[model samples]
Each structure stands twice: as C-alpha cells, then as structure tokens.
Target: MIDLLLQYGLFLAKTLTVVVAIALLMMAAVRARRGMGGSDDGDRLEILDLNERYKSLEQALKESCLSKKAYRAYVKAERKRRKARDKAQTEERQRLFVIDFNGDLRATEVAALRVLVTTILLDRRDGDQVLVRIENAGGTVHEHGLAASQLARLRAKGIHLTVAVDKVAASGGYLMACVADRIVAAPFAVIGSIGVLAELPNFHRLLERHGVDFELHTAGEYKRTLTLFGENTDAAREKLKGQLEDTHGLFKDFIREYRPALDLERVATGEYWHGSQAVALGLIDAIQTSDDLLLTASETTDLLQLKYSAHKKPIERLLASLQSAVAGRLAAWVGR
Candidate 1:
C-alpha cells in the first residue's frame, strides 16, 4: 500500500506539473496582452447564483417537452417563481460566500485567500456564511500555516465558516482544514494525513570523490541541521528528526485545539484515509461533496463565489513555457 501511495504521489506530481505549465502559458498570454495596454483586469469578488445553473437545466427540459406557446407561458411563470424565491432569500438576510483554494506545495493560493477573506470580513454580518472549496495535498510548513491562518480569520469574525474537500486535503492541507468550523468531504476524497514528513538527497560522498570542497557556516548550532553537499553527522540528522517530531506535535495540538473530540492518538499517525474512514476517525465533520453542499445551500441563501487573481513575473512565465514545450514533446512521443 505504501508503494502504491508513492507511485500515486509521483503521478500526482507529474500531473500537477502539467497543470502548472498550462496555467503559466495562459498567464503569459494575459501578461503580453496587458503589456500592450490591453484593458484586461484581474480577479474580483464574484457572486455566482448556483440556482441559475439548475434553472437553465429545468428550462431546457421544459422546452423539449412543451409546445412553443406553452414553453413561453412556462418561462413567464418560472420567472415569477424565481423572483419570489429571490425576494424570500433577501428577506431572510442569509448568504453563502464561496471561496476556492487549489493549493500547490508552496501554498501560493494563500495570498489570494487572504485578500478574499478580508473582503468577506469587511461586509459579512451575522447569518452570513463562508464556504471554501479546497483542493490541496499539503506543502511547506510556514506556507500552509499562513494559509490556515487566513481561514482562521473567517472564524475569528464570529461568522460560520465551512470548508468542503472534493478531492484531497492531506498534511498541510489538513492543517488548514482543521481550522474550519465544519468540514465536508466527498465519499471518495482523500482526507487525512495527520503527520509530518521531510526528505532530501545527500551528495557529500560524490563531492568528496570529485575533490570538491563544500563549506557551510551557520551562526547558530542548529541553523543548518541537514545539508545537500556537506557530510551529515549523526547528531545533525538526529536534530533534524527532532525538529520533525516537534512539528508533528504542533500539528497534533492544532488539530486538537480546533476539534477536541477527535482521538488524536489513534489517527494522527500520518496515515491518509478516504472520506468515509476519515468521518469514522473524527477527522472530518461529514461525508458529502462541495457540489451537494452548494446545491443545498443555494435553495434558501444567495451563493456567491469570491476569487482573487494576480499577475505573474516574466522569468516565471518563460520557465513555464519551457516546461510546457518539453512536456508537449514527451506527450507527442508517448502518443507515437
């Protein structure tokens, strides 16, 4: 099972690399157009009416079955019904503010998440709910920590904050998830990995054989506990392991602080679990997808999706183009 997970992890890494390459290409095009004084502005607070989608589907079905005159009459009645429904929602003074976080290992979405959260904080009153649809497999410590703090801001405002995981939210992702007032995961979604991991390759032996000298100076004793080229002493390696264990302790404490009901000792072993299993282990609140939650919430409240977009750097764009080109060639070769 561990081997399978490792293999799957590799596949996921490659898939995400491809996704990143494509996103970078699109961003580069946007950047070029903007450089030419194109009036293409970036992201804003988007309010999506989930009902509009369902309504369109309903109208399509009605149109296929009803005569032209009957369809026209049906459409007029439907408009009236929708107006009444919208009025009721306004009267109730309830709303659903949706945000999305597709996190990379670096947790790059944190910046956008912070912007969106602050916007919601400014105007969101009581009876207003926030929903975050998160897709992440965790990453660096401080990065995900900052991301989790962004979510924490919503709860700090005395507003209800719910998070839905449709695919995976392990490790640093779960670090952020545990901050939610409620967590909902799809049945097949990967949900838990209540542990910490750190790994690297050492090349000191190769360097020594090649008559290369590498010197790393640290002002503090534990400043550089592990290295890529310099020899790693037993004491240094132990210090690194100790640091990981300390991080694991902090992670467990964070989870317990937010969700004290979970049996942390039983499940915080760095083992990933499916949605149903996670629910049983008390790692999540419910077993349901984001789509279902949005559909159900939209029936009575106005569902608005919030997003934040920014510009990318030129060098980053160039690197992405190169990666995409290489990936494209490999794909073509595989096809042949």
Candidate 2:
C-alpha cells in the first residue's frame, strides 16, 4: 500500500511538471504573437506562427513523457508545415537557369540538365532567356549529340537561348553551340571542329605469337567493320572511312540549317580557329564574355541563377537529430 501511494505521487508530480511547462509555452507563444502586431497572414506572420507552434509543441514533448505515437504526430505536422513554406517561397520568385557544360561531357550531366531545363521553362517568365556557357574540347559523337538535343528543346519552346564560348567549343561542342539563337565567343576562343574519326587496335599478330586464335562470325556482310583481335582488310578500312564522312556530312548540314550564311565547304575542313578568325569566317556572331553580358544587362534586367537542389525533408532532419541525441547520451554514459 505504501509503494502504491509512492508510485501515484511520482505520477502526479510528473503530470504537474508537464502541465507547468505547457502553460509556460502557451504564454510565451501568446506574448510572441502579440509582439508581432498580430498582422495578417503574410510571410513574416506565417513564419512566426509556425516557429511559435513548433516551439510550444517541442517544449511539451520535452517536459512530458510523450508516447511514440504522439512524438510521430508532432513530427508529421512539422514536416507538413515546412513543406508548405518551401513551396510558397519557391513559387514567389522568377529565376534564370544557367547550364555550364565544361570539359568532357557525361550522360549524368545531360540527365540533370534535362530536368533543369524543364523546371526553368515551367518556372521562368516567357521572355527570360537561358545561357549555356560551353567549353568542350570534344568527345564521342553520340554523347555530344544527346547534349545538343537537350539544348534544342529550348528552341522548340520558342524560348531565347544563347551560348557563350570562352575557351574552346570544337567538334561536337560546336554542334551544341550552333543550336543557340545567339552565339557569343571570346576573341581568342577556339571554335569549330567539323569532322569525325574512329580508331581501332589489332592484336592478331600478338595472339598468333602466343598460339592463340579467335574467330568472329557475323550474320550481316558489314556487321563488324574493324576488329581488335582479327585482321583488318582494305574493304573494312574503306567502309569505316565512309561512315566518318557520312557523319561529317550530317554535322555540316546541321550547321547549314541553323546558320545558312556559313560557307559549308570552308568551315567543314576539320579545322579550328580563334574567335576573331571564326567571326570573320562567320562561325560566331560577336565577341563577348558571359560575365560582361550579365554585368551590362543587370542594369536593366534581373540576373538570377535557377537551380533545383534536393534537400533533406524536415522529418528526416528531425529523425537524424533524435538519433544524434541518443548516440551522444549513450557515449556520455559509456565514458563515465
């Protein structure tokens, strides 16, 4: 009977402590709301209200013996509130998305850029333009071809797209630059590399010396033009050369379709030239850096960089914080 009474007294003491903490939190929230002038539900008011509610609820949980269910409920509510706030803020602004494709390109970069372009088109104003600062030395035909196709989407939407080449935009990189409505390059930038090439290594002699032999079977006559371990024939070499020429023809045609004024024969010689020479050769329109253009335009136009970044959700952050707290306490006990 005495033990039962002691248990009851402890429960009542914990309940009273929780009640006092809740009362203090409510009072603090009320004071904060009043101090904020009880304004209409604007940005500031919404933020302040969320903060107060969060603080009060957090205090209640901390001071009382909250069950797991109640803790989860509070965390969900906080997450919803934060998500709503983030959506509101994101919708309130107009931004310009800049895609900088430098060095050798990769497929992942292209995928990230596809999403970025779609988001910008949906979020930006109708008149806003996208700036692609290109500096690619050149790479595989198909790899850069896909990159060029991504840029072409902007043109399909009738959105103004500009490409600025600073250091170099050769071969497949030039393929991408030509898709832009306006092409700007620094005076000494290397531009243009209108050609295609393929290299193959043969190890038939090496394998023959090692007493190893390999045979390849193909259903089609030109299925495999060149081989690494098999002997290469003149017919195979001619076929490969024809393929490269065909690809080069397509590259020249693409440029002609976009910039009709270009002399196809002169520019398609697999040659690269500086920006000034390129401008004279009709490869680029004017000489200008992206920074200079942005600085000058900022006087009248707003310069904004549009980016879509994934951040940890509020629930995830809260869970991480809770785990960290538990770990810290466990470590402290172990240390003692």
Candidate 3:
C-alpha cells in the first residue's frame, strides 16, 4: 500500500512538472508576441570574410606547428606574395558570395534567402558568382518553390549560381538545387526524391464508435474532399488522388524545365540516390563538399558568406534554450 502511494505521488509530481512547464512556455510566448517591436542590428545582413577567416586559420596553424623564426619567415614570404598579387591585379577582383540554406519542413529559411538574393541582385558586380550551400532533405511544395525561385532570380540576372550539398538535397531540396548552373555534392550526400505527398489521419470510425457526430459543410464539391472527422467516400479519395497526380505532374515539368537532360521517366519515380549515383543520373554535376569548394575559391576570389539574421526577444531566446535543452535530454534518453 505504501509503495503504491509512493509511485502515484511520483507520477503526480511528473504530471505537475509538465503542466507547469507548458504553462510557463505559453505565458512567455504571449508576452513575447505582445512586446515585440522594430528590428535592430541583430536583424541585418551579416557578411563574413571567408578569405580573411581562412588566412587567420592558416596563420594560427603555422604558428602552432613552426618555430618562431620559421613562422616569421613564412609570414614575411606570404605578405610579399600577397603584395605582388595585389599589385598585378589593378582591376577589381571577382567576388564569390556564399549563401547557406538549412531548410525544414516549412522552408522557413526562404524568408532570409529572399532578402539575401535581393541584396545580391542590387550589389553584384561583373564576374561575381553565387555559391549556395544547401542542407535540406525536402519540404512543403509552395514554400520550397518560393525558395527555388529566389535562387532562380540570380540565374535570371545572368549571374552564375552554384549549389553545393554536403548532405541531403532530396525532393523539394533538389527542386532548389536544380536551379543552379552547377550542382556539387559530397560523394555520399543524398540527392533526388522528386515527388509529392500528403497525408492525414481520419477519426470518423473512432467518433462513430463513441456515438459522436461530425458535420462538415462546404460550398464546392471538392473543397472538403478529405477530412479528419467526416466519413471519407471513394469519390472523395479518387478526387484527392487525382489532385496529387496533378501536383506530381507539375513537379516533373518544373524539373524538366531546369534540367532538360535528366530522364524524367527514370528519376521521377520518387526514389533517391547518393552523390556518385546522382552524377551518373545527371542530378549533380560534381562530387565535392562545400568546404573544399569554398577553400579553393578563397585562393583566387574574395569569398563572402552572406546571411540575414533576425532579431529575437529575450523571452524567445530563453524559450529556444529551453527547447534545445529538452530536445537534448530527450535525444540522450532515446539513444540509451
């Protein structure tokens, strides 16, 4: 009896802790929404000079590995070489603007991507190139389309656009990648998955079992074809399936427009391939990681990493930290 009471008490405490955490999160969100105001320095275009950063890294490594005399000699020679190169190149050096897109299910990064694209369109110089490093498996259709359109904007203006994928770039991710003049990927990076998918749970039978009625009204015939509560008919199912096929048709056409050489019949099967296979399949031009590409380009070109950062309130920061902590704990627990 005592052990049972102890177990129940522990369960109650756990429940109360969860409830309090959720309540606090809700309150914080409400306050943050109400108090949010204008943007500041925290929200702006942040550019990192990859060339200087790489030079610093190289200098640090040499300083650690070489004797003081040897390091000084190396620095002197490097400065002389740089000075000579700069003197010879009296004209403006070409620039390579590097952009990164880490996409999610909603393609929220499009907000920043559009801004970066607009900025580049305004400030781009002759012979300037854009290298977008993308790490995304896939996402929603319309959102990814918007993201892809931003990349296309560069190509539209006759600016060379290169996309590098160190990881996965399947489906909607590949959609954006296809817009690039050249696509590079790490050997094992996942590529392709040109497909459309939509799914939802139906609780009609469950509600019926509980004697619950769900009434749904719509003006159009196909407007409410699929629902979570209302009974789904064969006609409704057929209509939904037809809509999916129509969407898939549009997806294939879009890819064909960008990559005309790709065999749509073979690749548009809703399947994915790694980098090497992708090359043979014409999904990617080369098998190379973004880091290697950037490092090599830094030698001859001014590499600038561009990103738009949004300002976040203190409450938002706190909430993000809390979410990250919880996610880490949950991941650890699951791993165990």
Best-fitting candidate, scored by lDDT = 3
User: Over the stretch 153-197, how does candidate 3's per-residue lDDT look in tens digits?
Assistant: 999999999999987788888999999999999998888888888
Candidate order by TM-score, decreasing, is 3, 1, 2
Between candidates 1 and 3, which one is better according to lDDT?
Answer: 3
For candidate 2, give the lDDT of residue 49.
27
For 38-127, candidate 1 gives per-residue lDDT tens digits of 856554556666667767887899999999999999989988987987677645548888888876667777888888888888887779
In angstroms, the error of model 2 at 70 is 57
RMSD of 2: 20.8
User: Looking at model 2, which ten-residue stretch has the lowest summed lDDT?
Assistant: 42-51
What would the TM-scores of all predictions be? Answer: 0.79, 0.62, 0.83
Q: Model 2 Cα displacement at 119 (Å)? A: 1.0
lDDT of each: 0.84, 0.74, 0.88
lDDT of 1: 0.84
lDDT for 89 in candidate 3 is 91
Scored by lDDT, model 2 comes in at 0.74
Question: Where is the poorest 10-residue window by lDDT in model 3?
Answer: 327-336
